[model samples]
Target: MSDPAPDGLMPFQAMEILKRAKAMEATGRTVCHLELGEPGSPPAPKVIEAVTKALPQAQGYTNAKGLAELREGLSAYYSAQHGVSVDPDLILASMGSSAGFILAFHAAFRPGARIAITRPGYPAYVNTLLGLGFGVAEIPLTAANGWRLTGAEIAATHAASPFEGLLFASPANPTGATVDREGLRDIVDTCARLGVRLISDEIYHGLDYRGPSVSALELTRDAVVINSFSKYYCMTGWRIGWMVMPEDLIRRTEILQQNLFISAPTLSQIAATVALGERDYSEEQKAGYAANRGLLHDGLSTLGFALGEPSDGAFYAYAGIAKFSNDSLEFCERMLEEAGVAITPGIDFDRVGGQGYVRLSYAGKRESIELALERMAKALR
Candidate 1:
């Protein structure tokens, strides 16, 4: 048998921190969770009601691409949210963005293809590429530049050696910095010029605290756009995500999804269709995230943690912890053990410049944020 795929994948540090925090809780310690990026709010009431109503219908497998209604709903959503028209036929739903990424990699790239990904990015991007026997060109980002990845950076990296694909995220994970229309157009143009396939991760689009998040779909029809109900919709456990692929790639992705996923959770697809129509529910959740973001920003700054840029969207504050410790892993471990506050080490996102950084997720309740801050202040002092 093949040796278990190369063991180069790093585990998500936030989940590991959660496990440790749970163990502490088991021992009667109260822990404030600031590690994972899950929303504190529950799924929309309409979503739950829809799921409950559909449960007795013996919901079965949907088309590999997704239910017609959900796909249409997603198309309508994009049209309303970004003012971009999308064809329902181009949408394919998978278990989550994770599975969508896998299907996309298989459909768009061949084994051994070199892909460009930004460091200080979601770890799963690199891990998944390596697992599929692909070469990765990691472009490093810095706090000085607000951690933005530009077309110039991509061009410089490609000049060093050719790469076939590029993966990018907006309102990015960990840092939460978002690019504007002009910047996005530059990257899209560069990718087209270089003949590189682009995969845009827009999972956190609706969770923006600053302004609207731009979708790659607005600028190019040549890219694969992946999104999920897991973040802004507060449905992480539902395991539903969708991808909008170029017209030519639709059939290929559908075949891959047919074999790999068969369908996204049927119940989730049904409920998500309803969830999309409940705009007020989603807006309320976004408001909570905005409040939590402010609390984390002021609280962390007061604790001397340096933030790179104002997190334009998403519910995280990736702060510099150099003033406390250069070893972020050790620092976080100590925080969990002594401060009763759990956070993720930056190494999981940025292997090179991460040792002095930490990612604090502010998706928890206001009381929890206040408590964590108080405990962190006392422990660090």
Candidate 2:
């Protein structure tokens, strides 16, 4: 008899580590959580107040494209923040960037079409594409180039084995490698030249430390851009985000959202609209993340972890663990069990080259990061 099985969708390892940490905390053990890309801050007071007022009036599902109010706010956001004009009609609110990705993938590509993504990237990009019956080609980014993805690499990879789409992020996950404006332009032009549809993940946009993040909208109108209130606004649990779709993909995406998600949470859409005007709160949070980034980077270096490139954005420090161990999974396990510190294994990001690396998130409080450093020094060093 043939075995009945589902597609092998790998678990997101950061969540696995967080689960272990929570379990330890449940048993009276103190744990320093450095896993997950989640910011440990609460949502802005304005967001909370807005949602509180919205709950009583909470209505039914919005149109599949989301509320006009939310979509209009997002349109104004791109114009104000990125200096690029986006039509309100081109915007769609999503149940976090996860739904946005699913809708974009289905609308942008046919079944079995190949897409290019970076290694040491968000694991969901590869996993989601695979689960949807699409092929993925990974472009490896290394420390020699500050872990940045370049136009040349895209061109070369396509020359060898062509892909129909490119899914990319700046201030990338796990690594925090952000591409500058010139670099981003090169990548956009290259994708245009190659006729590869680009899907830009800009969830971590405003969290950049080095400089401003460049949006694909500033360079081209063809790319599908995704952003979330979860990161910048400290609204992860809200599960709300928005997408800027190319003209060609708008109707297709709208139809997909109708069938697949119905719409982003009605309450979240309302709250997210308020979030767009509360950048002051988000900016204050960014300053705290900047400090945490320094603390984690310096502390990890002191422990002989080789940190390549400045973590110019986001809140993670992806450190090479070759100095301590070769197996990142086992290293993380030992760290959690013995040191009471929970971090994600690099294998979660890069399947082939991740064995010698680990990703530590610095999105928590200053005291927690200090405690983690102290514990690791005593336990490992």
Candidate 3:
């Protein structure tokens, strides 16, 4: 039999490793989980309260496009927060950004067409592209650029091997790196010239520390904007999210969304609509992430783990683990086994340069994060 994902990734592979760790925990080993991007905050108080009132009315599925009320809330939220206007008619709801990603990937590009994404980015991006039978094109972004994507890089990159679309995530996974407004505009303009479909994974929107979040809608109208209640709203398990597409792509995306997910859950949509109204709570969570990022920033530097970039957003610090472990996979397993710290090996991210890195997440409670830093300090030493 052939081996699956010669790349060492797969939702199942992640599960297999986590499963063993989970099974081991049955015997009661301490596990400090820093491996996943799963948010750690409680759902907003108002959202939960809405759910309490929605149970009897939300037992059945709603329209395949999701509750119009929820879609309208998303539209208004984007316009008010981002200085951009999106049509509720253009919104297609799905079961979290995972479903949105698949639908967009399928609708935007055909199988065997190439797609470009940054190295050491979200592992799921590469996995999703390949699973759709597409070619993986690499754009090696370095720490020098704030891990930012430049127009020149995209234009020069495609000269060697081009792609049909580009996927980007500011305040990105693992590294927590982001781009400024000018940088984002450069990337979008270049893609427009290259005839590349741009899919901006704005799942981590509103989680930045330094400045405002930049949206693709601000730069170009011809991109797929995928977002979720999963991140900013702290509704990870509810499986609800949405997409913003160009006017022309709306019907096509709706067709795919219909077959792929009969409809978004009725209760979750009701709850998420209320979430859009709770800006104060979302900002509070963003502030907490900023504080955790600072604690981790000072602590990790003290522990001697060389950081990849000056992380300004998201909840992770991707570091160069070269001094301690030549192999990130072996290192992650050892961190779990010896230090009781669970972290993700970098190989799951950038296949080429990932051997020397591991990611640490600060998404846990304050005390748990401190405990992890204490243990990792010793492990690194």
Which of the numbered candidates is closest to the native, going by highest lDDT? 2
Candidate 1 structure lDDT: 0.89
lDDT of 3 by residue, 103-139 (tens): 8888888778889999878877888877778888889
Evaluate model 3: give its TM-score: 0.95
Which scores greater on lDDT, model 1 or model 3? 1
Estimate, for each residue in 158-187, the C-alpha lDDT of model 2 and write its tens digit.
Answer: 999999999999989989999899999999
Residue 365 error, candidate 3, Å: 1.0
lDDT of each: 0.89, 0.90, 0.83
Query: Which stretches of candidate 3 lie above 4 Å from their native place?
Result: 1-3, 6-17
Task: Show the lowest summed lDDT stretch of 10 residues, model 3.
Answer: 7-16
**Which regions of candidate 1 are displaced past 4 Å?**
1-7
